[model samples]
Target chain A: MNDSRYVSTAQVAEVLGVGVTTVKRWVDEGILPAHRTAGGHRKLLLADVLRLARQSNFPNQNLGPLFAAGHALVPAHVQDLEQALFVALERGDGDLVRSLIQGAYRRGVPVDDLADGVIAPAMQRIGHDWETGKIDVFHEHRGSQLCVAALHELIGLVSSSAAGRRPLALGGAPEKDPYVLTSLLAELVLRQDGWQVVNLGPNTPLASLRKAVNELKPRLLWLTVSYLEDADTFLTEYRQLYQESDRLGVPVAVGGRALTDSLRARMPYTTYGDGMAHLSAFARTLSPGKRRPPRGRPTKQSNG
Target chain B: MNDSRYVSTAQVAEVLGVGVTTVKRWVDEGILPAHRTAGGHRKLLLADVLRLARQSNFPNQNLGPLFAAGHALVPAHVQDLEQALFVALERGDGDLVRSLIQGAYRRGVPVDDLADGVIAPAMQRIGHDWETGKIDVFHEHRGSQLCVAALHELIGLVSSSAAGRRPLALGGAPEKDPYVLTSLLAELVLRQDGWQVVNLGPNTPLASLRKAVNELKPRLLWLTVSYLEDADTFLTEYRQLYQESDRLGVPVAVGGRALTDSLRARMPYTTYGDGMAHLSAFARTLSPGKRRPPRGRPTKQSNG
Candidate 1:
C-alpha cells in the first residue's frame, strides 16, 4: 500500500473485492476501526483498511507510506485547562467557562483543540453522569447550556472568521438528532483553521444538507450524529447522501459517538477521528494553507 | 363555569364521571380536542371542555361559573410586522431581521409577541416552503439559522433580563427533540413577565425535568414537542412526567404544533395557546404583580 494515513472506505472496499455494503457492515459490525468526519464521512485508518483486506483472504502486503502517523498538537497545560473548564461547566459557571476558554486561547491552545479535548469530553462526562444518575437533569441541562454559551463566545472571538473564498465548509447533525453542539464545535474548529463554515445546526434533514451542498459547494462537509436510536433510517439517509454528493469533488466528513465501528466501514465517505485536531489536520491536508491569504481580516464571505 | 376561560382535564373528567385516563383517551383517541401548556399541562377551551363532557353523555347540567374566557392579545401592528419578518427571513437578511425586531420592541410590540406572532410564524412559513418544495434544504437550513440568530439578538437586547424573587420558570423540548428555538422564545416570554428562566433546551429527558422542578421549585415548567416520530414513546414520557410532578405545585405547561388535539388530552398538564402573546398572558395570570414593582428595571432577578 502506498503512503497515506487515511483511506476512504471506497478504497478499502476495492482492495477487498467486496461491495461497499459489506465494508460498511464490517465497520458497523465493529470488524474495522475507523474515524468519522464532521460531515458524517467515514475515513479508515491505514492499518484497519489493510487488516480488512487481509481478513478477506487477500495476500499479505507491506503498507509503507500509507501508514502515516498524526502527532499530538495539544500541550499538557491545555489538557489541565480542560479539567478546569469541566468544573466550571458542572458548576454552571458561564463566566468561569468563558474565562477558562478565553484564557486557553490566549495561552495559544488552539481553539479547535479546546473544543475537541476540553468541551467535547467535558460534555461527554456530564452526559455520562446524567446517564448514571450522578447528577440530576437540571445540572446536566445547565452544563449543556454553559458549553453552548462558551462555544458561542469562542465563535465570536474568532478574528479571521472568513472573508471570501477561504475554503468554505458546511455541515450539521442529521435530522432527528438535535445535537447542535458537535456541529457548532466543528464550525469553530474549521473557522480557527481559517475555513469559513456554515453550521446547519441540530435536527437538520438530508434535504437541507443536500441543499447546502448544492448552494455552497463547500470544500468540505461535516455531519455529526450524536443521537442514533433509528440506525436503519439513519444509515439509509447516510448512504443516500454519500451517493447524491458523489458528483461534487467536495469531501464529506462524518463523525460523533453515534458512528459504531461496523457502521463506519459501511459508510462510503471519509471518517474523522475524535476532536477538532483530527478535523483541523484533515482540513490542512485537503486544502493546505487555504487560510493563509486573509489573515486577521474581519469581513463577510462574498458570494462565490 | 365561574368566569374561567380554561379548565383542567381533571375537572372535565370529573364532570363526565370518568377517570382522567379515560378523558385523556377521549383526547388521545380523537374523541376530544384540547390544548397544552408550556409545562406539559393540558388546558381546553371552556367551550371545547363542555362539548367533550356533553359528548361523553355528560348531564345537561350547566358548567355554570366554572367556564371562563381568554381574549385574544396579539395586536394588529404586531400581526402586520409578522409579514415583514417573513420577508426578511426569506431574503436571509439577518441585519434587516434584527433591525425590524429592535424597531418592533421600540414601538411597544412586546418581545414575547414578537416571538409568538412574528418569529414563530415566519419560521413556520419557511418550514412550510421547505416541505412543499418552494425552497430546498439549503434555504430551509439557512432560514432556521437566521431565526435562531434573530432570537439570540433579541434575547441580548432585553434590558434588565431578570430581577430577584421573580416567578422562576424552566422548560425545554423533550428528549430527542432537538428544537431549542421554542425553548429560547419561551425564555424571553417568561423573562418579560419577571420570571427568571433556565431554558434546558431541546432533547431534555423527564428525569432532568423532574430534577429541575425539585431544585427550582419554579412557579411554572414548560415542555414543548416540536418533532415527534415516536409518538408512543413521547406520550409515555409525557404522561409519566405529568404523574411524577403531580406533588409539586409547579404547573407543567405543555404546548407546540406537535401537541395533537388527542395527544394534548392524554397528557395531563396545562396547555398554552399558539404564540408568545398567549404565553405572556398566561404568565401574568399565573403570577400577577410579579412584574409590577420591577417594571422596566434591567436588573438581575433578586431571590424571593
Candidate 2:
C-alpha cells in the first residue's frame, strides 16, 4: 500500500477538530496507529483516523474537512451516515450534505447504496415533510436543489473513475416528468455499475429517445417516470420506443415513483426496478464483464 | 486588496504548464511582474500570469490546469474562449469545457456572457452539426452531456457565492418541452444576478407551477420553451399561469427556440428575453440592490 494514502498528524487534528498534540497523544497511547516519516513526522492511515473518529463519537459535522480532503477509501457505517445526512439536509446545510455523501463514497460506500439507502430515503422524508406542511415549499426546494448539487458532484467523481469503454446506457425521465433527482440518482447508480451512461435527464420525449436508440445504439435504455401528464399518451409512445429498442436488441429498464404496477403492467420493459438497488443488480447481469471493479479500485474494509 | 489573492512563483509555473526557472526568467526580464515575500520568494499576480498566457498564444488546452486553479480573477477574451469551448465540446473533452467556462466566470466574465457568447453558440454549432449529419448521435449526446455537466458545476460555484436571501425565481420548461440546457443556463444567469432560483427543470406542468407560485410566492418566474409538442395547449395553460403570477405580483420571464414570433405574440410575459443577457439585464432591474458584486468579490484586471 502507498504510504501517501496516509495523512500527517496535523491533517488528522484538523479533520477531527482537535489539536496536533492531542493527535500525538492518541498515537502515543495506541488509541490510533501511526508510522513515522524520515523526518519523524507521524503519518496515520486515513482509515484508522476515521475509525477512531467513529468510535470516539466525533460529530459528523467535524468530518467536513475530511470529506473535502478526498483522501483514501475507508468504509463508513451506512446507518450512521444516513442519519447524519438526514440531519444535515434538514438543517439546509448543503456543504455538510456534500461532505457526508462524498466522504462516504470515497470511503467505499457503493453508489447504489448511497442512492437507495441514503439519498433516496432522505429525500423521500423531505418530500413527505413538504406534503404534510412540516416544511415550506421554499425550504423543500432548497433541500432538493442541494441534493441535486450533491448528486452532480458525485456524478463527476464517479465519471472520473469510469472507463469510457463500458457498455452504453442512455436514459432519462419520459415526457411530462420533471423530477430531476430520481433520474440523476439512476444515472449515478448505473454509472457505478460500470456502464457508460448518457443521461438525457428529465423530460425527454419518447420520439427523441427512439432516435437515440437508432443512432447511439446503447446497450441499455432506461426510463425514470416520476410523473405522467397523460398516461394514455405515455403508454402509446412508450410502446413505440420499446419496439425500437427491441428491434435494435437493446434492453429497456424502467423505474420511478410514477411507474405504478398498473402503469408498468401496460409498459413493457426488460426489467422493472423498484429502486436503485434493483437497477444496479439488473445492470450487473447485463454486463457481467464489468462486474469486476475498475483498475486502481480503492481498497475497503468492513467492520467485520 | 488582499495580497493573498496573489499566487506564488511555483503556482504560476504550474498553472502555465512551465518550469519555475522559466517563470522566474520571465519575471526578471520584465515579461511578467512580481512581488517579493519577506523570505524573497517571488509572488506573481495571477492576473498577470493569465494575461501573459493569453498574449503569448499559449494553447487554450494548456490553460486547463490554470482554469482548475480557481485563484485570482483576470478578464479573458470571450471570443477566444468561445472558440476554445467549441473545440473542446466537439472533442468531448468535458473537463476542458468545465475549466474554460469556470475559469472565465472566476475571471469576471458575467454568467450571461458565458451563457450567450460562449456556451450557447458552441452548443448551437454542435446541434447544427448533428442535424447536418456531420457527427454521430452519440457524439452529439456526449457533447450535450458534457455541457450539462459543466453547467451544473457552474451552478454549484455560483450558488456558493449566492446570499440565499435574494428574490426567488421559480420556473422550468413547460409540459411537452424536454430541453435541459436552456433552463439550467437561465438558472445560472439568474443566480449570478442574485436570484435564489428554484429551477423545477424540464417538463413541468403549468398547473403544478401554479401550485408552486401559490405556496412559494416567488418574486419572479421563468419558462424556457425549447420544444413544444402542442402549441395550443401550452398557450391555454400559460394564460392560466400568467393570470396566477399576475395575481401573485410575480414577473414572468419567457424565452426559447419554440417561441416563434407568431407564438410569442399570443403568449404574454412580463418580459421576453431573447437570451441569457436579456434575462441578466432584466434580473438586474428587479434587484438593483444586488447590482454590486457580493462582498469579497474577486478584484479582476483587464488586459486593455
Per lDDT, the best of the predicted structures is 2
lDDT of 2 by residue, B1-304 (tens): 3343476676676555445887788788887898888888887776787676555433333344465334432224677778788888887665577778777776567788889988888888888898898875555666777888888877876763434466878888887675678988999988766677777766677877887888779888888999899999889999999999999899999999899999999988999988999988888888756545447855552211
Residue B204 of model 2 has an lDDT of: 71
lDDT of 2 at A57: 41
What candidate 2 gets wrong by more than 4 Å, as runs, is A1-65, A68-109, A121-146, A157-183, A189-304, B1-77, B160-164, B291-304
lDDT by residue for model 1 (B70-165), tens: 212212366666777777777765445655665466434667777877888888898898789898766767667767755654554452423446
Per-prediction TM-score of chain B? 0.67, 0.76
lDDT of 2 at B65: 43
Cα lDDT tens digits for candidate 2, A1-304: 1212346787887676566676787776655655543234565655556545533444331555545455323236777777788777776676688788877876556677888888888888888887997865545555776788788878765542221255888888886676778889988877655567778767677887898788778889988888999999999999999999998899999998887888877878899988988887888788744222112212231222
Candidate 2 lDDT at A122 equals 85
Q: Distance (Å) between predicted and true CA of A73, model 1?
A: 25
